[model samples]
Target: MAMTHLQPDPSPYPADAFAAFELLSSAILVIDDDGLIRYANAPAEDLFEVSVRQLYAVQAGDLFRDGEQLRQSLEEARRHLFADKRQILEIDRLGREPTQVSVTVVALDGQPWPALIELREIEQQLKVDREERLLEQAQANRELLRNLAHEIKNPLGGLRGAAQLLEAELSDPALIEYTQVIIQEADRLQTLVDRLLVPHRAPRIVGDVNIHEVCERVRSLVLAEYPNGLRIVRDYDAAIPEFRGDKAQLIQAVLNVVRNAAEALSARIAAGDAEITLRTRVARQVTLAKQRFRLALELHVMDNGPGIPPELLDRIFHPLVSGREGGSGLGLTLTQTFVQQHEGVIECDSRPGLTDFRLLLPLP
Candidate 1:
């Protein structure tokens, strides 16, 4: 159904009636007793992706994908139940993905409007909750990996020593070669175990860090490696100030991200159209690591790769969770650890032809 072209009559209330609603972060809707939306606030316009003109006179129930529950709640309100009630609802925007919103119905008593509706994006709240869970999970993973690595290290040393002694006792060259293989494989396992233990060791080294310089260093290193078919683009903001962090670790973190992107773009690289963009901007009044900062920096690493697989995207930061074959999968886990050490967060967004890894860090 199309929105009715009916206009609101303002004579029943003060001229500044909706002024307070525009200031609120919550999306608000003023509905008449007929259940038609009389007015929608700025936040409502944004949340619904519709203008006030379009929402005006539209039945409030029509906005939701399944709004029968909403209609009942409104009926309850019109019967003089002025108590506020809240429930979750899904809104299907035209040609856009459906959005989940927490809706609260507040019944108005003997006023210009019969009801007031409030909408809040539940996904945004879930993101904050998910970040907290991720931080806790990462810490526990570090402790577990550290203990496991240490336990394996001692036995691995003894096993390699026994293999060497066995080789010394063997006179036949063929038998000695078998012992050498055992020793070589043992050393390889030891190296992998040490890498697993590295995150638990080496405290974060902190100093004045220029983010742009870090990006430049990683850019040069990556370009040197993929000089033939890949390109690294820089779109940086000069306003980002220096922050106290481990410059080396930050470089490693960026390098890991860029290198991963390059690897994912191997197909595109062979096609001679591979590209990775390093874009930076200053983020103001942002939240990271459960703390709100007046200023933060956003570093976006974008690539024209095929993108991460759907199954591996969520677990990309987990140890040994690489998407590519023969991949150790520790790159992103260590990158996450390094970024978290500086009170930052890294998240990825991907589709078929594009992938973006965004890192946010607080600034001094």
Candidate 2:
């Protein structure tokens, strides 16, 4: 099914004919008649894990494991100038998991680069879908948790007050101890309910926020708690500009993520190898919560710790779901609420030794 190797033909257009697509979110590749890659845009290079100069050095067929199928698609594309030919390919590359890429080939007649191929990694689309679903779930949980917390909160106060009065009138020491236990447990549950209601009561405090400052503050707070063995690293992009957001809410949101990572590193911390990295970068042409933004701030909180349990990965942000013993599980829920208030998103990816919590917020 391979096409006959065509001789080199001089293209009439300038070398930058496909310049407009370089900034496109999808990967763009322009293949010459000989099947040599003449141009690989930024996203394409990123998708293939190859630089433009290096991408040119390899034959186009080398990028995919099923080269014959790709060649057959190309042959068909070459025969029909106006037809759209598509194939899903597993891009073969080193040090990266094989990616499922949807390859779309469109023929351009009377052009130097006779074929334009677009490569879109399906994983990114799946990631967006996952984020949207998480956002919706978080919203629903917030409403349900708020109402449930209130329902439990009212009777809790009466129970504690009754226990206190019963303890005051008791003369037997053994029975007094039982009343004391009841009061203590009631107080503990009340505190938990107060935490559940905190996010709803906090007002949005808007201002220009520098993400680095937020990271630094969270680092300081986390280090104060786990100072003996934990190390916080800052990997920041100095060029990222400030955007309008709730500084306090952003601080709390990032704090929850970092703190959760730190908590997960308990074994690592005890072993004297705990580490958390706060990374910041500028994301362009980004979409969050269904709205597109020309620029967005990308913040990642990464930890070298035992990763989140696989069973709880999808529901970690839901209220009262925690992977750790004695965890209240409200941290990530509040974090999600705060980020969504600013029209942003928070997502987590975890494996055995690595965990990444990414926050994507549109920049003004």
**Local error of candidate 1 at 208, Å?**
0.8
Please, what are the lDDT tens digits per residue for candidate 1 over residues 247-277? Answer: 9899999999999999999988898999999
Compared with the true structure, model 1 gives a TM-score of 0.71
Strongest candidate by TM-score: 1
RMSDs, each prediction? 6.6, 6.1
lDDT of candidate model 2 versus the reference: 0.82
- Among residues 3 or more apart in sequence or in different chains, the pairs in candidate 1 whose N, CA or C atoms overlap within 3 Å are none
Question: Which candidate tops lDDT?
Answer: 1
How high is each candidate's TM-score?
A: 0.71, 0.71
Q: What lDDT tens digits, residue by residue, belong to model 2 across residues 85-125?
A: 88888876677677788888888777766687888788787
